[model samples]
Target: MLDVLVIGGGPAGSTAATLLARKGFSVRLLERDKFPRFQIGESLLPYNNDLFDRLGVSDELKRGEYFPKYGAHFVTGDGRTEFTFRFDRILPPEHQRSFQVRRSEFDHLLLRNAAASGVDVREETPVTSVRLENESCFVRVASGEEIEARFVIDGSGHASLLGSRTGKKSDIASLKKIAVFAHYRGVEKPKGRDAGNTTIVVIRDGWFWLIPVTGELMSVGLVVDRDHFVNCGLSAEELLERSIAATPFVAERMKSAGRVTQVYSRKDFSYRVRDLVGKRFALIGDAAGFLDPIFSTGVYMAMKSADIAADAVEARLRKGSMRGLERYERDMTRALGRYFHFISNFYRREFLEVFLQPSNRFGLLHAIVRILAGNVFGAAGDRLKLALFFVLVRIQKRRPVIARPIRWEALPRAASL
Candidate 1:
């Protein structure tokens, strides 16, 4: 019997298994797909640097050829606005700097590190069923192999392996955008102070992301209205070309870009499961919930959630008490809720205006980034920061206007026409 059975090999499962293995626990990680596979969400937040170091794989992560992103740059219809938030500006000098890596390489590196940490990794063996029979969990793999474990972790990305089997999945209704992304070579990267910055370009309809991963390679994606794609009688490739062309700044940069991969698309990228934990099983990463990728917070949330789940499982196995499991749910919900609220508010124009306003915006962003750099967890501080930011936005909108007396006479309307 395995101490813990993790049903995915992505960031969450791998992190959980690796951490548990380091604690001298027997961990079995089953991944349906093999490593070195193509994946998306290539950007990494500086906050993840600490987690990497904790796993003792910081040297390996640093060895990958990656672009060092300092902060994010935004472009609205008016013009470009750059926010240069260096990790060193808020984090310790040793923990400063994050990388924009190619997901294929990054995920494989993490999985290999997990194996190196003494995890029993099963690749190309998909999970078919999970059952709680006779007070024990049994996992059935695609090869008709049955593996019993004291606890199970559902990290099967959107498959929601354990969550679905236990009827714990529910969709969040607010998010309704579709995403189309592709990798390109020879794409122009930002220069000088703006080098390695992720650019978010907002057009009339929706937004686009430009993330540079290497010297000449970049990942470009569009999050647009689903209906718009349906109305336009163009293939995904054509739509991407037209959309990029319409956005002058992005179009000019991709003039000589050659496609490195086919266009990949997914609709309704946001949803949350009703429950994160049930009995002996727990959900992680997209299996728990998935917000859009606009903020590049997916991978960070995944590994963080895994860390929380690993702690819970370790306590349960060692002391035969489920008390730590409850804390896991609370922490996961609190951590995810903070990001969910912040991302949900990004769609509102008034919120955007207040968020861009210098005084309140910069101060609040600094505080939150500091918390992330410090790896603050298991509390309401994250949520508190989000609430403060939103309150400032509301105050800006509700400020009463002062009436001023007009001294000039009114002109005739017909003369103007």
Candidate 2:
């Protein structure tokens, strides 16, 4: 019997398996697909770099087509704004900038690192079923092979493998948005003032993400309202192109670009699993739930949750009890709660309008950005900062004098509305 059985070889699974194996646990990882696969969420925040270091896979990223990013740029209806809050800027001299990467190479590097650290890796192996018998978890492979383990981890991403089997999976209707995107080689990269910055172009119906990966290939995507797309009578690809063209900022950059790959659609991308854990089984990554990618926080959140799970599992193993899993569940809920609030807040233009007023000085806008980049949730100082910022904004808004058109360029510098 394996000490731990991890399903799905994505960032969360590999990280968990590697850490558990290093702690002397007999870990087995089952993956449905081979590595070098194409996946989205190309941008990386500084925290993800820390995760790579924890898994001892930092060097692999350095040798690839990676680009240093100091901050993000926003182009909204009002104007353009720039934010430069890289970890290197806030923390230490040794803390350099983060990198934008292609998931095909990035995910493969992570999973391979886990294998190198002695996790028994299984590729092209699909988990057929999971059964909790007695006190152990039995995982069956498609070939009728059975693997028994004291605990099982579901990192199956959106597949929600075990989660679907348990009938606890459900769609998050409020977040029913669809994404269509493609890679382009000749796409213009931000230069001079725009250099080293990722751009988020906000249009009427939705938003477009302009991520410049290495090798002159940029990842461009359109996230549109599901209802709008359904009513337009246009295919996802055509709708995406039309939306991108509608955004003057995005169109200015992508006008002459040629699509280097097929347009792909990620449908009904938001969801949540009612329960994140069972007797001897737990879910992580997209398996647990997924929110919109507006802030590009998906991978960071997944890896962070993995670290939390790894630590709890390690402690539980040492204590010879499964009680630590309770803490994991609690932490996961608290951690994702903040993001749920932030993303839900993002979809409402009326909520953002408060920030567009110059007299608004609650600093809620800035504080929320910082909190999103760091704590996510948990009652940390950043959370308090965000709260206070909101309080201040509400008080300031009570006065009619604090009303002014917030210019687009000033978006990054908005006080706290």
Candidate 3:
């Protein structure tokens, strides 16, 4: 039997395969799609630098050409309220900045790096089902080939191959979100440090993301409530145009830009897979759970889960026991819970009121900066910092700190007109 079999060669699976092979475990990775395939989630978190270092792709990234994302700007579509959080302003993490990448390029680089580290990678091989019959683990592929391994990892991105087979995946009812996006060129973006900045253009019911995927191509997308989208009775392209036209912030930037790719609509699943850890299998990345993408936590959380799963898988290989598994679950749950809490409040006017108006009281704004920099999974001090920030949000609700709570008075009138 093989030591480990990783499903899906995305960030999570490839990361686990690379780390495990480096630890002397025989690893084989299967990817449903071939390399250089199109994928989304182009924006990355600041702390992904360390993960890149661990995967030994730091040199390739530093030397290679890619957009260096310094920080992110959250702005109202009208430009009345805005806040920018820079990674350099934070401490603790040595490398605080991240990169805006075309998913096709970044993912291909990671998978190829895994192969260089001795991971047996097979592309265009989709896992049909995973059967854990007693102690023997086997994965059935699309070609009717059965691959046997001592342990199996469900890193399948959106397919959730294992989660669907075992009926472990369930939807989160609260999050009914749809993302409509496409690529464009000739758009005039900010210069200097702001050149690589991702702008979150906040609208009344939804928001738009502006990311520079390359020196020339900009990835622009709108994320809105499902009801609001369906009620419009328009296609994804129409919705995107309507939204951009209504939002002055994105309208100004995209004025001279022209669409260069087909508009794609992604329904946010927000699905959770139960029993992430089992005797012979584990779900690492998107297969484990799907988080809201408002904070661009998908890549960071996926790689982090893979890093943790590698330790657990290594322990299981050495001790022949399911050790370190519980810790993986605990740490990921804690981190995801914190993010979910923060994301849940993001759509509310009360939370946005305080969050947009940055405050540095008692280092609280720095705490917000820390979370924005992807420091959610840290010491107890991290929790305390986030808690204090939420306290300020509540306090700001009752008594306005920087200004009165935004009534969006002019927005409704403009919409009606």
Candidate 4:
């Protein structure tokens, strides 16, 4: 019998397995795919610097070939007005920047790091089923072998190992959306120092994310409501092209760019699993829940939750109770709720009106920067400031407190890069 069995080999699984093994627990991690696999979510938050430092991979990242992202650039869909939320505004100089990584290499590095930490890592081994029976879990692999473990941690990204087996998911009605994306070569980027900043263009129906993953490559994606796509009657690739052509801001950057990979689409991307903890099981990462990537919170939240899960699993195995697991559920719930609320309001014009115009009168911009940097668990005073900011957005909706942003003309005129 194993002390703990972790499903999937993404950041959540690798981080949890590594942490548990360091505690002297017999841990095994199963990943369905091989290393260096292509994955999305290339934009990372500055908060990740803290996690990597603790995970013992900070030095490796410095030695690796990755781009440092100092801040996020927000642009109007028409490319008229914009703002850049510099991470240094809130974080210290040493921790003010994160990175834009090719998920393929970054995830592989983390998985290998886990193996170095004494974790029994297995790649290309997919899990078939996970059964929770009393104080232990029975995990069956695709090869017909069954292993019993004292506890199970589900980090299977969107596959949701335990979630699918237990029917613990609910659709996010207001956020029924789809994402169409691919890699490109020679996309226009900002000048030096600003080149690494992730550019986000907010459109009428959705938004566009342009991430400089490497010196020669950029990951561009279009996110919009599902109905909007269906009504257009275009394939994934066509949808991406039409979206780019419609948005002059994005079209301008891609003028010199060429597609390097086939387009891929993901739909119904928003959902929540309330029952994240069980008697002897727990869900981490995307297996727990997923909102949106507006604030680039996916990877940070995954690893952070895995870090928290490792401690809760350790306590559960030692104390012989579910209290630790329950606490994990509550903490993750609160954290996810904060992001959800912000994302839910992000699509509204009122939110953009207020967000485009930053203010520090009552430390509201300070509060916004905290959340943008993935620090959702700030003090009560921060929460008050965030609430006041939201109230200001609501007020702006009823009464125009500022000038309305400029819109694009029928034929977008090319803008300087």
| Candidate 4 wrong stretches, greater than 4 Å | 402-417
Off by more than 4 A, model 2 = 77-96, 192-194, 354-366, 377-379, 392-403, 406-417
- Positional deviation of residue 194's Cα in model 2 after best superposition, in angstroms: 5.0
Encode model 1's per-residue lDDT on 48-142: one tens digit a residue.
88788998877877776877776666665334433444566656776567778998888888899999999999999999998876456999999
Model 1: ten consecutive residues of lowest lDDT: 408-417
In model 3, pairs of residues that clash are none
TM-score of each: 0.90, 0.89, 0.96, 0.96
Evaluate residue 134 in candidate 4 and report its C-alpha lDDT on the 0 to 100 scale. 83
Off by over 4 Å in 3: 401-403, 412-417
Residue 197 error for model 2, in Å? 2.6
lDDT score of residue 19 within candidate 1: 93
Mind sharing the TM-score for model 2? 0.89
| Candidate scoring better on TM-score of 2 and 3 | 3
Supply candidate 3's per-residue lDDT for 26.
86
Off by over 4 Å in 1: 77-82, 360-362, 371-385, 396-417
After superposition on all C-alphas, the RMSD of every candidate to the true structure, in Å, is 6.3, 4.6, 1.9, 2.9
lDDT (Cα atoms) of all candidates against the true structure = 0.75, 0.73, 0.84, 0.86
lDDT by residue for model 2 over 1-417, one digit each (tens)?
A: 788999999888888888889888999999999888889988877656667787887786777778766666665733453244344444443334567888888889888888999999999999999998767989999989998898899999999888898888888888898888898867776665345566776655567788888758889888877776677778766876766665566667777888889899998888888778766777888888888998787788778778878877776666755666777887777777777876776654443444333221444445554553554635476676656655544554565333342343432211111
**Candidate 4 residue-wise lDDT, 91-113, digit = tens:** 67665888889999999999998
Score residue 201 of candidate 1 by CA lDDT. 68
